[model samples]
Target chain A: MLETVATGHQAKVSAERGAERSLLSQVPLLSELPVQDLTRIEQQCRYRRFTADELIVDRDSPSTDLLFLVRGQVRIVNYSMSGREITYEELTSGAFLGEISAIDGAPRSTGVMAIEDSLVLALPRSVFLDLCTRYPNLALKVMQRLAAMVRAAQDRILDLSTLAAQSRVQAELLRQAQAHRNRPNAAIIEPIPVHSDIASRVSTTRETVARVLNDLARKGILERCKGALVIHDMRRLQSMVSDVRG
Target chain B: MLETVATGHQAKVSAERGAERSLLSQVPLLSELPVQDLTRIEQQCRYRRFTADELIVDRDSPSTDLLFLVRGQVRIVNYSMSGREITYEELTSGAFLGEISAIDGAPRSTGVMAIEDSLVLALPRSVFLDLCTRYPNLALKVMQRLAAMVRAAQDRILDLSTLAAQSRVQAELLRQAQAHRNRPNAAIIEPIPVHSDIASRVSTTRETVARVLNDLARKGILERCKGALVIHDMRRLQSMVSDVRG
Candidate 1:
């Protein structure tokens, strides 16, 4: 009976390891890593769960463990001194977080809140650094990701400094459409972006987002379908964005 | 004699090498590299010069050589499709540029314009990547720099999205004062910031910047001295910023 119990326990542990390995395979940085290498790092990590609307990482926290989002979604956000919340970006499954603080040992730039029930694989800072040092490609991938963030941020800053409110709304739609690529010269924002979510992205109010959508719909640029917003006049819409971006 | 000519040539070459070494020493990323390592990289780089107001790196250029600013200043800028100019940031001597493109092999995010007669040391993208791969500390520094940029940009985005025009001005002054820390509870903005520069930073008009300064002076929050702007009440100024940030 004791021998059978030992075998059953081994099977359970092996099943958990198999599940962990599958999640690790989803991370773009670790995707190219060999199976054994992925197994080695995942073994050094622990799994954690957070429920919807729960804080995953505190902004002022000093801990800096790199986290891999294996399932569900989370958003990077911060509250103004006045307690107004600002959402920076959202991450879905297969994405990762905490690399900035992990690399520099600084407090997080913003807090992370789970938008849905999330399962994360957390790797200690030391182990993550060692992994980067061992894999040049991993380091390059991280650098590229950081560079893209900088580029996106700069574009936003420029837009905020120059574009009018209407143009800003148009520019934001084009941005969203580009992110959700479609056929040649045509695009659709799938999952139907909420007015408040688009408001945050464009640094405006939900009312303004609704107004802009109405204007676009009337102009035959875009229209809301059952579950998506279809952008039809890609050329005209792009011209509107460039009108102020110019 | 041929031997005498060779000796003179060697002296001239050593003098150039000495100057290059001193400049490389100033780069924060390369400062920790050994003298021989610095010399090796410098030997592989070529020096380039630009006149004041000249374009150093075109925004659409395909080249991605990492550049070290050995002398003078350059501003990262972009023109809107309609010809409106946006100044992103400025880099002075000892600072570096082009790492974003070098890491991602992407197009330049913005053009670099020489603000004064300048000298730059250009290293091939491959050499820079090789150096980063070989030096873990160097990679860490680059990552840290990129992270800092993201943090700063996010702060700007939040301010633009929420703060009133006057509050943005107050917040900007607080930001600049913190950057140029002086005695506790007081700070001096030396060389007195130009209204246009502050305008760009706060995403307001030059008139707005001037009006805000005048209002602050009337309230005894800050005063204009002969060559600088002095903040006499840092706490009050900070409180005003937090009023909106809050």
Candidate 2:
């Protein structure tokens, strides 16, 4: 069902400017901004909420807002001609979205949907432009964040275009394993997401993921623990990643 | 046969700082930089030359430089285990390469090759860091550029993962036609490299490109003009793009 909300929704978005400044201080992009600038940015920011499955922004629409996720999860997705949905990337707290379109005054390339109840700090394009006009440092920090994201996408493109289904799954698992290793004192192995969600990211089907995971488990490379695959041999998995980008 | 010359030939790099500043002035990423800052950046630039088929940068190497195309073309490519090469994008004048890795201090994600005898302005990572420190405006512009690139890649990912071979080819042809429309009015469509090049970019076999072009020719959708495919029906071709991306 399509629901249209009034633009007055903007009025309801209250900014706790002091709180926002402190919160944004923890974010790399905003943290780089001097305290005075951060406070000015926070004063112009507004908070908004989205329920699960609601469209945060529609694809191809003129984007006028920048979103900084404060809570919950989101999925970047698009629809195919067959009416089949393609999930591209998942976003969580601290992630920024829609910045390019907002910055350039262009239409958005993909749609955003909340995967869970989401709270976001939404900044208007006008305010963002004002900040850019006032502070070059803020712009540089934004670019640094964008550059890092683009690099990640480059790695992902290499994997998707070159790797086999099995290798793609393995490499993704290794990526998650490495990410988990950064968390303190936890078992280095991560609780892998459901096979379906994993399939969405790899552009494969759940059946294929299940089959591959089962095979890996049989080989004693990964084990089922608490219904999640726990990687036991990272070297074996790392060897598989090169093949993905070969 | 490998041509053995000095590891680096007379490099033929044109580091004309004034000309670079002018050229960069036209590009959005550097357009906003003050004239003085632009001149400073130009001083830190160096030019490099590469012969056709030369690997300018290999996959997985540390990224220490960013390339600005002054003249000629380069191909951004990835390879599969079975030795199949896929051309992701072609870079011509005004295009920048490796900025993502350069900014992120990460390894190169794809191999860059000189598609023709090419001249490029190479900016070392240290210079980039200096620019970031000296001019935040330039940094923001770089970030916006990176964000746009990421969006472009996301679009490509959707295309490659979801579209069929023939549809992808047709959409690519339409894109090319749009791009060439701005070129000086000419009787002949420009000569593209080969069917294989087109196939690699769209992630299909060369045979498929040949077959599809022939089919389109037979259908009066496209015609051969001076050995180049001249699109005869743009409306029908646009519909194909919509259908593929729908």
Candidate 3:
């Protein structure tokens, strides 16, 4: 079921019937689908690969394929008319994209780029819509995902409205730490993006982010390692956020 | 199938069977549904009335009923832990609420208050879900609405992040003008919310909003009438937003 069609530095691990079922089972949305429906979905998936910094989908493009990240990371971004880039979100493995455009049949709102060499499974819009129509639970799951997305956006708006620059940077750091935390009472975020990327996410300048981060490091709250950040005192960092929000 | 149940200042307009179907037919989600399915949905709706400024649903309340605004307006707002009020959105007739929480089975994310004496038809969660399961088109319609909501929230975040205080206020006014514009090349926004409310929506102080409005009035871009703001130069106001955004 797991067939290695090509094995090299950049390999293509083709999924057969059983492997496809297992992969679909791991996805929250497709997992609830019945075995037959899952099989149908798997049959429609086409595996694709992109190297780091590759443009997967251009902004305003008419691409409506649903993409599921099989490996690595992708960033959704928008470019202003003046050529300023705003990063909306960074999604890692197992996350999906293009649901909004696919559902509404509108042009893509943001461009998606591969931040790291990535493997993705693309499902055509027709197949995705058919599945949603045939499977009620799948439709419900999609709605739930959309609802959660709306809530997260609202939270971000609240932070941007109320928090100061330093607090916003700190809050974004804490958020990333929580997302990538692997140990208890501490978090080590590896492969951290550059200060400019962080600035774009938090809507601040790179200099501001650097200043706040350096200040935090001086306070013994976090340390910058080779390619990651190690948060030593999460409680202190959390209190900092509360102080600003309060 | 139409029947008049009551007639008073605050009376429940209990809809008869045919009248209920006709009313449901007006809702975007239910309009496309088959007549029989629409009848089923109408059978489950309970007519409700609220006076102006009535608290229809409290934040975090376990109210899962789907509210369809039949007449009048409502505001969705959130109060922060520190008692800061944020107005999320305003809904008018034919719009639906509570779909997000009902889909996710989470507590109400925001409080819904009637901005005017409003008439709403509340559909129980079970009936809503049943209708969704049986009618895929209805589910698709719900997904599209959620998608639109997500996009709007994202737009708001962008405005908050990139625009300055004065520009943010101008952008919000332009948005309102577009929404309530009745005449070509001009707009009349009636019963405008207080300056404090506008400040809350745009994430600025009331004094700043007043200053901006006074400046605009002096420039002859807008005029403050008894209970409405008349925009004499919609193009000029719009160009202000483009200048800031660009």
Candidate 4:
């Protein structure tokens, strides 16, 4: 009976390790890490589960760990003195948060809250720094990821500064289409969350999102089927984004 | 005379080395490298000089080198099919440009041009990777810098998405004040660049910039004295930005 219990414990540990590896595999920054390195990294990670609306990272708090989203979604938000809370971005699986603060050795600038029930793997800064020092490839990958995020932010700035409202909505739809296109059997239809989530991405209100989406539907460019946003004419939407940019 | 010439040659070489050290000093990314490593890294640097309006980077071209704005200024611009050119940012001394492509080994997404006679120190991919590998602290600094740039981009996005035209201008002024504060300033009266440059940073037209500046002057928030812009009331300008955000 003692031997059997020991075996069961080992099996459970193995399963947990497997889950950690799977999560690491999904993160683009960690995708290139060797299996041994990943296992070591997994060992350094602290796993925590969060319920909906739970604050994962608080503004002004010292950031000691890098949080990687394993399942569900997280929202990055900024609250102003006027009591306006702006949702900057929605982060899903395969995304990491708090890296900037961890790297800078600074306090968190914004709050990160779970949008739904979620699991996160938090890697301590000491371990991350050690890995970065030992593995140059990992450092390069992190830099690349950060640079890409910067580019995405630049694109957002361009949209907000120059693109028209209709065009902004269309550009977002195209982004959704491309994201969903990567999955298996992606051609049939894509699942988008709520209009509110979409609104947060584009920095518009949900009412504006609904109005523009309805306009697109009326124009025969898109359709709502089975509670999913379906693109009937991708070319038209592309043109709209281009027009707004121009 | 021969001795003088020999001494001058040695001086010139010493000066070159000194300039390299200064450049290395300003860039936290290269600070932790040893002398020999820095010499090797400097060897990989391609020094290029550009006259006013010369294109350092063309949009859509594969980005091959990271340009360090060692001296003078450069402008980042995005051109559209409708022949509209929007100036995104101006990079001055000690600022880095063209890092997006260099970091990702990807194509240049925006055009960069010398707005003034400029000297740029460029590092290729191999040298960048080498530095990252040899010095982990340098890698951390690079990541931190990239993160800061990303944060700046996010701020720009927020301003564009949420703020109106007038507020965008005011926010930009506040940013300028902050940047000036970071620099070694001799006095409160700083020579403001051309209105066009300010317009670019704020995502407005030159005429609009002029109009706004004139209005602010009338409001006693700022004053133009001997071709210099003096902020008479920082509180008022900040309040203007806050009002716009609201």
- Return whichever of 2 and 4 wins on TM-score: 2
Q: Please report, as a value between 0 and 1, the fraction of native contacts recovered by candidate 2.
A: 0.54
Q: Against the hidden reference, what TM-scores do the models get?
A: 0.89, 0.84, 0.84, 0.82
Error (Å) of candidate 3 at residue A98 is 0.8
> Where does model 4 sit among the CAPRI classes?
acceptable
What is candidate 1's lDDT per residue for A1-246, written digit by digit as tens?
001123444445448657545568888878889988888887677667678988888887887889899888999887766666777789999998988888888888788989998878888999999888888778888899899888988888788777877788898788888887687677889889998887777777789889999999999989899999999888898988766776
Clashing pairs in 3: none
Write candidate 2's Cα lDDT for A102-218 as tens digits.
Answer: 777788878889999887777889887666656666665676667666666666666666677788888777777777654332224545578887877877778888998898778
Per-model chain A TM: 0.87, 0.81, 0.83, 0.79
Overlapping backbone residue pairs in candidate 4 total: 0
lDDT by residue (A81-197, candidate 3, tens digit) is 566567888888878888988898888877888999887777888888888898898899889889998887877777787778888999988888888777665799888658999
DockQ of each: 0.55, 0.49, 0.53, 0.44
Better of 1 and 2 by DockQ: 1
Residue pairs with clashing backbones, model 1: A81-B245, A81-B246, A82-B246, A246-B80, A246-B81, A246-B82
Docking class of 1: medium
Report the error of model 2 at residue B201, Å.
Answer: 1.0
lDDT of 4 by residue, B106-150 (tens): 888688888898777778876776667777787777888887876
Native-to-model Cα distance after best TM-score fit, residue B179 in candidate 2, in Å: 2.2
Cα RMSDs of all predictions?
5.8, 4.6, 5.3, 6.8
User: Chain B TM per candidate, please?
Assistant: 0.87, 0.81, 0.84, 0.81
List the pairs of residues colliding in candidate 2: A139-B140, A143-B143
Worst 10 residues of 3 chain B by lDDT: B1-10
Q: Residue B86's C-alpha lDDT in candidate 3?
A: 76
Off by over 4 Å in 4: A1-46, A79-88, A181-189, B1-28, B80-88, B179-189, B243-246
